[model samples]
Target: MRYFIIPALGLISLNTYANVIQYFTGISYANPAELFKIKQTELIIGGTGFHTVGKFEGSVLNFNTGQYGEGSAYTRTTSLLPYGRIAKRFNEKTVFAVDVTQPFHSNLNWDEQAFTRYAATQTYLTDIDISPRLSYSLSKQWYVGAGINLNFLQNNETNWALPINPTASANMVNRTTGFGTGYDLGIYHVFNQSNFLGLVYYSAIRQNTSGTSMLANRINPNLQFNFSLPATTVLSYVHLFNEKWLTNLQVFVSEWDVNQYVRFINTSAPPPLNPDFTFTMRFRKSAAFVAAIRHQYTQKTGLTLIGVIDHGPEKDEFRPLNFPSDTQYFLALAGDYRVNENTTIELLYGYGYEKTFMNNHVQVNGQNLPFTTGKVHLSANVVDLRLKIQA
Candidate 1:
């Protein structure tokens, strides 16, 4: 069929849907079951046809600290994320889509540097995103969609210290990347075919950075900081009984109290800390629940099973550099094979578990750090492959 719709739009255009929330904080009830079976109309062709989806993931993070260092440490990771998408259907009542992915990657690293030497021993964070969407269907139940989000960010940090006397020895590097734009809105409703409801809103993404500071050129170079991306809301629901069985629920709210303070324009500043340090932070709202089951072990072959529950984000907004918050659980298995009636092949596997909380602080440069309070455990395993064609 048109070469299986050009590899199913090049695999849903390497779709990353914001990593379902930047690395699964939760949400992705299989994305409305692939947008309701690809907006069928017999898979609409002339009405508009284009699709692509791609995904690759690997993760591991473990840390056990009775007081930091000399205890436990493990952080191994791998990622090869990609996405590209373009969809069109304008006659039967408009439907447009545009996609791009590479949602976050700052080059994570750390095989040595056992703890602290001066903060960062190695750091890298990356991201790239572009999305354009339009959906309208004020009839058969109701629908609405709006999108425009562009983002590109990079962050880097390096450290090395050895000042016992040698002229206050030094070696510290910090680099930050930039580019940002945001706005996203979504609404979906369908009280028939089975049941569905969705609501999404995301806004608040700002990046403006310039770097340089080998300890500020030996102790006072020029440095700047401005990185913010906290404003989100999502509510979802889905239900399908007969035809196979599926259920999902999601909720997320974030404002992070506007994530106050990170500014350091013009360099030199580190003594006025404590605006309650932003209420110490410990959860700003996140909830998830999912269930899936589909079987059609006939015609061609099909099977799907998924289960998840994630509720994370708390513990003083923990930031051991960045990206940390645990309370996750997962189990997934997917399969689909159809070498005829067009073409189809898909497989997926998943397993995850997480729980983290740590605290121990004292810094004004006086250094007494031994951060890490309680439980900290994480495990993840995922594999996905896809090939779909129909034209």
Candidate 2:
């Protein structure tokens, strides 16, 4: 949340997830040894994604009755992110690859006239990373890999109801175009021909952003802030019953507790609006589980079913407006097609549902913002398609 006390007015709570709640979540994919089976070289292109549709509803309170009131509905829409990978097997025991992907991304908008406008209006954030990796097979059953990441992050947000004038709105913009560096390491092992295990770890990324808060009339410049992306670890298991039936289990963990508060620097505000202030971010260390089963119908085609259970990052009571649900469930169906000896394609479709967060509320500047506290409900549909070429 980006709420603040105005210079001449009362406390104003700004629900700005664009900057606070939208930090790096976790790794999009964790299979570094996925290309060990590629013959000599592989080129992947055209990342097709089915967008996520989020429906939001903010609950409001009636001060007169001292009770919570009804809420209004809003929706958030986003397109699929870009992803690509190119890998080359230099020898029987070594492989090299490069990947381009958007690991963290979000964009949302609210009705300007809605009761929840003061807490949040608009938010957009994106992070792009380019990775170069190398993998080696120490023996026939053991494999190891590592990668270097170059990251680029950007953010912008809008909030309404400035303390100076309740009807007024404010916008925030920042300059975060510098490249950051991080690394990833992975290990893979095969037991006999039926059991396999894999694990990957991604380091944290520190980003320093500087910018200002813009109002309808005045510009608040000379502001600076710093935040670090959380670290993540993933573990996976694969079981092959036969050539036609296989199963996979994966676990993903994110260490968001490492950095849960954001410190803001404003050199100009007086006393109460001192040079340094902090806000509790809406995130916590969490883990998710995925189960998948694949069936080989023929040599040229196959089908896979995947199910996911994600315990969201926010706790119920402390959850912010940005996190509408505490948990999410998803089921996906995927189809694989062997276009030819050199080309392969995969398409996946999924449906997800979020458990509603009810009676949600937050206090800013020690003031209970009933209007900003409300119930939230959301659900989504996702699609993904990718192509792989080998030679």
Candidate 3:
């Protein structure tokens, strides 16, 4: 029931969506289940995304006044990712396809002189995914899908304002790239000509990363570490009310609990020079719900409406904040026009808002730890343009 202007990223590589406060959980034009009825070879190319501005207000302990103060973080950013898909039918029962997308993304930055500066002054996370897959008809009403993954992940965090002493400050940073392989499996079943169901799963991938860690603003030690990307499952359903109306619903489940901390260490460095840096990012299991309704008003053009609700993983008590996130709602509109028998073009525009509640603590030498709770305002809009061609 909650509706607002939150940006829906380009949905193929995305709404195929957002990461960080979210991980690709939004209404999309491309779902793997879209191949269910394609009898011929097809290609889809598109671009999606927009810009965001935010204001951060939080509780902070003031040393001189011995009272809590508010507002320390601010950010403005723009994000746009790519998407493409190619599906070719080998037989009546088998279809081969390749999808190129950026599955997950997160970019949240904090100013250098903020009260919440120690945890991270900068944070970014995203990945590129290429999957080649096959969907085969098991029967007149059932289809099965399998695929292989080539994934590349990138992560960066810069920790600043370490309270080494009253006279000085320190900085720490860890930036790395992870590459690995995984698998995708899915099943699709249809009850009739107008209705069907789909389920797909993506396995967790291991990132063996090599990068440098900046410790205490001095030593830059080369380090290595291994981290895991969370596995995900999606269930989708579609039904046509009549010749002119249709609806699609999807439930996305993510195993975000599998991720904890990425610890980096230098094997060859001396004890004094050994810098063991750990990036803490912990989460609980989460899910998102989405729906889309399409109405064809003319022979050459159609319109669709989309809605989504995503529950974030961070909850209860004090946890080091990795990204500001909470329950979010989104609404989007898309219109499509057929250029010819072989081509179709679609455009989507959307917007949304996020009100965040956070409980966080900072490391200090004092006996009493001050935990802060506050709100984050994320303002952004979404726009996407796509073209699909068939033979």
Candidate 4:
């Protein structure tokens, strides 16, 4: 599972009339050939091997609401992700692979007196994903693959505030969980021994989440949020020039229009909330470029330097509150070592810088609220280790 921590206090109470936030959790890349190249295996194996991997990510948020009615909120989250994969060659023309990964984990807390009297705290557990893929070699230079994905999700929320008097306080808690499934397809073509092109398509996955909400003085009934996982298309290319230079390019497009509504059950006669809530999320897209060079000073060791750029998509009003929409840039470096024929290790370090703009309005409980419009900056560092064995 992946864990995210957001500090959203100070920014909520600031004097800002525009606020916009968007987030994307799936942004990891792995190359099997690179791993195999570092660990030369000769166990007469016709299938792929398995290994363990982990990741960590963190971020911060700040905002101000304004004068007598200003409220501030801050949050932070952390998550540990563990996963494994297996691959096999059924024949010279067919290959099968299965991978299980978890990339969603979160810790969020928000406090603001301008909108409500209480401070809200939420802990969300995103669904886990299990995928199995099958590939067919149409020719020596072309291949196609398809797969299925299953998901599981859970969440909990709590609110704290005072009743009629500021001296007395109360608490409310809510929790829910659900499951769903989806599919994916991919095609690739290789040219020479150093260049390749590939494309992947992901189908939309829908989750019908059900949960309960409880207040200090009342039972808020059951609530359901119909979450529609957007469909994505990715086109990628990789090139290797000699043994020292390499480049990778990828373009991603997602259909956010399918994310249409949030259905609440057992609240009030008319829902008692924002009635003008219309689904307006249209399209979200991005492009990424990576260029790296490796220098080998010895037969067993080498150093690689990489740089990447991510161009974010246009602003959308229907984006969820769980993700912050922003564009980012990354710089990374790593070292690879070959530990004989069956073992290898790689160490990597990277930093990301992000920027976002907030100029949208939101309506809650028949009230129009103004938020702060500015730029949010984020910095991140990452490390990864892998162990491979051939049998």
RMSD per model, one decimal:
19.4, 5.0, 7.6, 8.9
Candidate 4: residue 98 Cα off by (Å): 1.5
Estimate, for each residue in 322-387, the C-alpha lDDT of model 1 and write its tens digit.
334445667777777888876676666666655555453433234434343334454556665555
**What C-alpha lDDT does candidate 1 achieve relative to the native structure?**
0.47
What candidate 1 gets wrong by more than 4 Å, as runs, is: 1-136, 150-171, 175-179, 182-192, 195-208, 216-239, 242-245, 248-391
Per-residue lDDT of model 2, residues 182-284, tens digit only? 8989999988899999999889887666666554455567666566666778899999999999999988787766666665656233334444545565567
- Cα lDDT tens digits, model 4, 127-228, are 466777677777878777787877676563323332322233344344556788888888888887999888787777787766765545556556554556
Model 4 TM-score on a 0 to 1 scale: 0.70
Give TM per candidate: 0.30, 0.84, 0.84, 0.70
Shift in Å, residue 7, candidate 2: 10
lDDT: worst 10-residue window of model 4: 12-21
Tens-place lDDT per residue, model 3, 243-332, is: 999999988787877765555555222233224544445667778887899999899999999887787665534334346566777788
lDDT values, one for every candidate:
0.47, 0.62, 0.64, 0.45
Better of 2 and 3 by lDDT: 3
- The backbone clash count of each candidate, in order, is 26, 3, 10, 38
lDDT of model 3, residue 291: 87
